[model samples]
Target: MRKMLQVVAISAALGLLHAGPASAQNRVTYKSAKTETSYYQMGVQIAEAMKAGTKGDIIVTLEESQGSTQNVMEVRARGGDYVFTAPPPLVESAQSGSGPFKDKVDPKFTEIRALFPIPSLTMHFVARGDKGINSMADLAGKTVLLGKGTFGATEGEKYLKLFGLEGKVKLADAELSNAVGALKNGQIDAFVTAGSWPAPNVIEAAASTGVTVISLTDAQVKETGREKLTIPAGTYAGQKAPIQTTSLPVVAYATTAMKDDVAYALTKTFWQQKAAMSSGAAWWNGVDQSLMPAITGKIHPGALRYYKEAGFKLNPSQM
Candidate 1:
């Protein structure tokens, strides 16, 4: 009986030791854009980086999102482990209870905090190369598709109105994911998509069927109050000249509900894997410490710790 009791005790101790680290693993939920979009692929890359960086100590899971607006709204029900992507302007709007979030105000919006800057959202107005749609005004009689409930959709509509082509252009009633297909099938003459450049769908459409990206005139771009961005020549198939467009900076965020230590790990891991990630995805190369000022809201305390340790400067607004 004594010998049996000793063996049982030893086995119990070994089991506890093996279970300790597994129990300590931190799980996080990441939400971004639609599955077919570049933003969604970004979420996947981040999740993979987190898993590899922490060696299974921290696990990040992705949740398919319709757009940035839905990502913000989910924060109300999501706990601390929830991480999401959105533009600084949207975060500000949520914080102030204005714009799309005006009527859906909740205290959870105040809990939101910044993590790090991701790639900027660059608008792409793609049309069939053979079509005569070379400029915004060319779309006067063409059918266009702008995915609903996304920054691209809203911005596309706003641009049409700003450029005086609102009612003149026929809007397609279809999802953004299907925009490329619709264009290829001649169901739509053009489509507007916004994501990090070299957007997956855009590349597919441009490669399989030549497409033309509209270059906004300087005056039209300025009227929208968005920063001008120029897509380099030859960025897409058959695209020979630089395309002038507008962009909105985007960022990752979390709420105070998350623990400080977990946030610290997430921030640290992201910077560490950034180089490796950029090697695989060109969009990641666009992100650097210089864009910190573009991040809205206060930085999460956990992330701030990593930034301080790394000696990265932060804007006053971030503090």
Candidate 2:
């Protein structure tokens, strides 16, 4: 009896020694935009869908942050699994080492990997007619408000720099809601903001006072190397022509620490369920894989793997 018990104990010990490590659970925390905005809502919907679809292998949750710069900062500091951002801010941050990082390029800047891109928001630069702001050239020596956790501010600054208006203009920082009142009150000369067609604040300010939506000339667009968009006719109260300006792509990003399989599964799940996602938020519209990489910088190897396996052609830069 003692010999039999000893043999069974030894056998159990051997089995324990040979057993592979248990599958590590994947907990994905998505840092999204502010709570009241559509961006945040989209993140919530995606999180819920992924959580439901991933079964038990992955745990997904959503939280809100200030905007692009803050989201990027959080992703690095917290080691978050995913974050939502636009190409302009990311590009600007990497190039200037400004924005949230201010004076220094974040050490984790390279860890930012573009997963996929969604539809973009059009940037609108509105100036009170009395402010003497007429064209991009007129912005020199004026105060312009740019962005609110959005790319308009960062990209707008780039445009100013390109046009030789960097030191000439006062770049004021204010939220979109407050911008309308600020412009009406003459607190600032011009404001830069981005969003879908007919940004509500622009319309509201226009109704109360004469406001002009500054469009970027073609030459200016070419110099920035960013995507161009047109605010179509009848988009605003008095807009008569299609104003040409630049737009930024809203994209998903993952860190370098994320595994290829996890990024693959997450990317696959997003596309597979995007059809349903669009039904909830119109911003999810036009999430075509083909055009996403056009502006979004480098695609993560893990996400690139999924895109390639799914039969998508990626430009050399994205690869």
Candidate 3:
């Protein structure tokens, strides 16, 4: 009888142990529409920071999606918890509900909050130095390769249309390497891409084939209404001097549905360990904590909590 009682007690203890609240685990997934190197690097940084800060309580998985349109759609559909996207298209999609989305997103989606602002990506029109393509207007009637499956292409088209070059140039969609190769092979007169300083493909292609990155004039910048940014001298491998051109903004967004506690914890950890991320990749080198803008979309409660604790003004719209 004593042995039986002991056995029963052991069984009850085991059951209680098994029924104890399962360790709370918060897992979030991040998706990037296009596989830009910078986006992927940033995702890696975030994942590492989350893991370190959560002490293994939270796990973050990052993957590549089709692009901004698909990423925003999936996030709205609750298919993803976070995404990296450009501000222009994300804002345009959320506001107009037009284009690739076709009215699928709610205008209130503005609740999607910005985590940080990436450096302005400058548009580069690379051509063979001997090709004699001196300016944006010189691509007329020439077969030009615009970036494929990336924001560069979409934004390029918009700017081209704004500049009234819509029908005058033959646009071909191709990957950066292929576009550069086409230029090397003389199949295309020019290739257009927008990216951070020292764009790897552009630098490598120019080094191998002697290509030139054209600068946009002040008139062109004003006409386009985009911010003009300069690629400082020595940013690229062989560039002799600073290159000035109009730039487009790139930003990362976190879903509102993400738990506020987790977002707050992650944001706090990220800023505290900013050096960890900054030192991990060249792209992160220029990220400034002060430049992280107050996003328009729904801000994560956790982020708001962190901001308030830090004594920063918590704007009503951000909340």
Candidate 4:
């Protein structure tokens, strides 16, 4: 009886040890910027899907980092297996390696991969119609609140520089909600945010207080190489006419260096179960097969494999 009991105990210990390594190999870590709502939510959906499809063999661990800059850095350092990032920043990082990560890393630190393009994030420079802040050019010498530590701040800075208004504008970073409140309370002259239509905070604030959405002129759009975007009439609670706007492209990526097979499996599962991703977040409502290419970057080998298998002809030049 004693010998039989020892054998059972030893077998159980070995099984537990083997399970640990197996679990570790299948697990992936993801880092995202807390300020990006859609990216954060997408991460949740992907993680859940991965867990479900892999029968828990694959586990996704997520942590909120500073922003795109930090997310890329963490991925490069192998601190995480995947990251969510915007296109401009991702391009800037991979091409120049000089902005947020200047002097600390090489340009090739990241292997750019395509995930999906988010709907364009329209730039809204909100101010009281009575404040006399009518256009981007008029932002000169004005106190402005740029959405705090978010992609909006990055876009605001980019546009300000393009229009030679950087030095003329006094910019401060404020959380989206706080910036809206400040604008409503007359504490700030204007608040700049870049987001898809009906950003809840902006809509709620605009509804509560009469706010003007500034439009970028054609000349401004051409000069900045920005896309001419519009917030359709009635997008906001009270706004009537379509709000003419302009925006730089905002794209997101599921960047990972995992084996192509692993990446392929995940991407395939994600596309097959797209509806599952939309269950909790409206943001995923826009993630259809048609919108995939707008995400600029090299598709992960795994994703590429799946795409090819699906009868999609991918041009090498496009990559």
Candidate 5:
């Protein structure tokens, strides 16, 4: 619930000048991903913190969005006050006008600023347990769903290449629900779903039938060049033991136009309220200040000030 705020006068535009600290929009809109995903839930918690922490009267409202890649465009157009993004890698792609974003990404994407590095959201590769598949490479010569809903297809392809199965596997892109249905009917041999702790779809997949969560070995993870995260035992049924897997690093960001004090307050509030948010979603447990963004998106001045004052060391390149 958002606290009722006394309406502070708002202008039609709040063009924050890049020469120095500029005026910010007191009334802010936070754009997140689909309601069912972990990104949306975290967006809600972060928006609430933004609303709760401001010393001056400010309104921070959260809205569901298509995906992080889309949110980058929205933020660029000044369509919202804040936005959540895909892994640091994706953001880097969009910002640098490379990879999936090569021709379509806006040049202004560089103006976006990093608020905080969110915990790595992991995608689990699940297959019908009877398939006898134990790892990503096992899918060689089999049908698989790359899960290109929000995360790009390119990353999925990269994972395949790393496993030395790119040319060996037949891949299809589908929505999560449809992909799950396809798996149940044997239309596909395996599918990937990204989630925090216990990714709900993976649970549904296991409940529907015998399933195996395909994990990557350290060597495979190195080959993929993606961060590895552990899915603890019991996170999903039939997961008798912890498994190591490659994961995505999501980042929270705002425009350079956002004021320093507001950024500082919002960042501080999010960290302080982590425990409370965790009670509702175990995903909150992934929030860590030390896990700096691997991509080159510069930190916002306000957030950087708070981190420095709080004594958190940051990579010099980020400053």
Candidate 6:
């Protein structure tokens, strides 16, 4: 009986030793764009970084999102373990109960806190180069797909109206995921997509079918009131010149429901792994401490703790 008792105790101790790390693991759900989008790819990259950076202490699961608005809406039901990506403007809209969030406003929106900036949402108006579509005006009378429920779609529509192509251009009903395939088949003349450049879909479209990224003129860019961004020459397969466009800054965020320590660890892991992540994905190269000011809303206390420790200066609003 004494020997049997000793064996049982030993087995119990071994089991706990193996289970300790597993029990302490923190699981977080990271919501980004559709699986087919670059944002989703970035989520996968971030998840890998989080797991490795934390030595498996933190596990991140990627959730396919419909749009930024949808990502923000889920905050009402999500707890601290929920992490999402969205533009600063959308978060502001949610906080003020304006724009698409007007009818679905919740106080939980106020709980959203910034973590880190990813990549800016740079606009791409891609059209088949063989179709003689060289400029925004050329989009008139062409069938275009501006993906529904996304910032890209909204911006595309606004540009269509701004450039006087609204009633002239035919809008496709197909999903944006199908846009590249449709364009390659000559079924759609052009498509508007927003992602960090060298966007995968745009790359595929340009490489397979030869696409032209429409550039906005100085006057046109100024009229739109969006910050001007230039997609340098050779960004795509056939592109030979720079394309002027606008961009929306995007950031990672969590709610106040998350523990401070978890947030701090995540923030720290991101900065530490950023250089490594950038090596794999060129889009990550665009992110840096300079863009920290673009992160909207108050920073999560845990994330703030990491930032301060790293000696990053914070604006008053971030506090």
Choose 4 or 5, whichever is better by TM-score.
5
**Distance from true position, residue 198, model 5, in Å?**
2.7
Provide the overall lDDT of each model, using Cα atoms, as 2-decimal numbers.
0.91, 0.73, 0.70, 0.68, 0.73, 0.91
Report lDDT (Cα) of residue 221, candidate 4: 75
Which model, 1 or 3, shows the larger lDDT? 1
lDDT of 3 by residue, 210-270 (tens): 7768778888788877777777777666578777777667676776666777677667776
Ranking by lDDT: 6, 1, 2, 5, 3, 4
Candidate 2 at 178: error in angstroms? 1.9
Report how far off residue 140 is in candidate 6 (Å): 3.3
Off by over 4 Å in 5: 1-25, 52-58, 100-108, 148-153, 166-174, 293-295
- What would the per-residue lDDT of candidate 5 be over residues 231-257, giving only the tens digit for each residue? 778777888989898777777787777
- For model 3 the TM-score comes to 0.76
**Every model's Cα RMSD, please?**
3.1, 7.1, 4.6, 5.1, 8.0, 3.4
User: Which portions of model 6 show Cα errors greater than 4 Å?
Assistant: 1-23
What are the per-residue Cα lDDT tens digits for candidate 6 across 3-86?
A: 999999999999999998656989999999989778899999999999999998999999999888889999999998999999
* Model 1 bad stretches (over 4 Å): 1-23
TM-score, per-candidate, Cα-based: 0.86, 0.65, 0.76, 0.72, 0.79, 0.86
> Cα deviation in Å at residue 280, candidate 5?
0.8
Q: After superposing candidate 4 on the true structure, give the runs of residues whose Cα lies further than 4 Å from its correct spot.
A: 1-25, 35-38, 49-58, 88-92, 106-110, 118-121, 129-143, 147-150, 157-177, 248-256, 273-279, 286-294, 310-315
State in Å the error of residue 131, model 5: 2.9
**Poorly placed runs, candidate 2 (over 4 Å):** 1-26, 36-38, 51-59, 73-111, 127-151, 154-175, 182-190, 196-200, 203-212, 231-241, 295-298
Q: Local error of candidate 3 at 150, Å?
A: 3.4
Model 4 CA lDDT for position 231: 69
lDDT tens per residue, model 2, 121-198? 667889997776768888887777875545666667777788898788887767756788888888888888776545
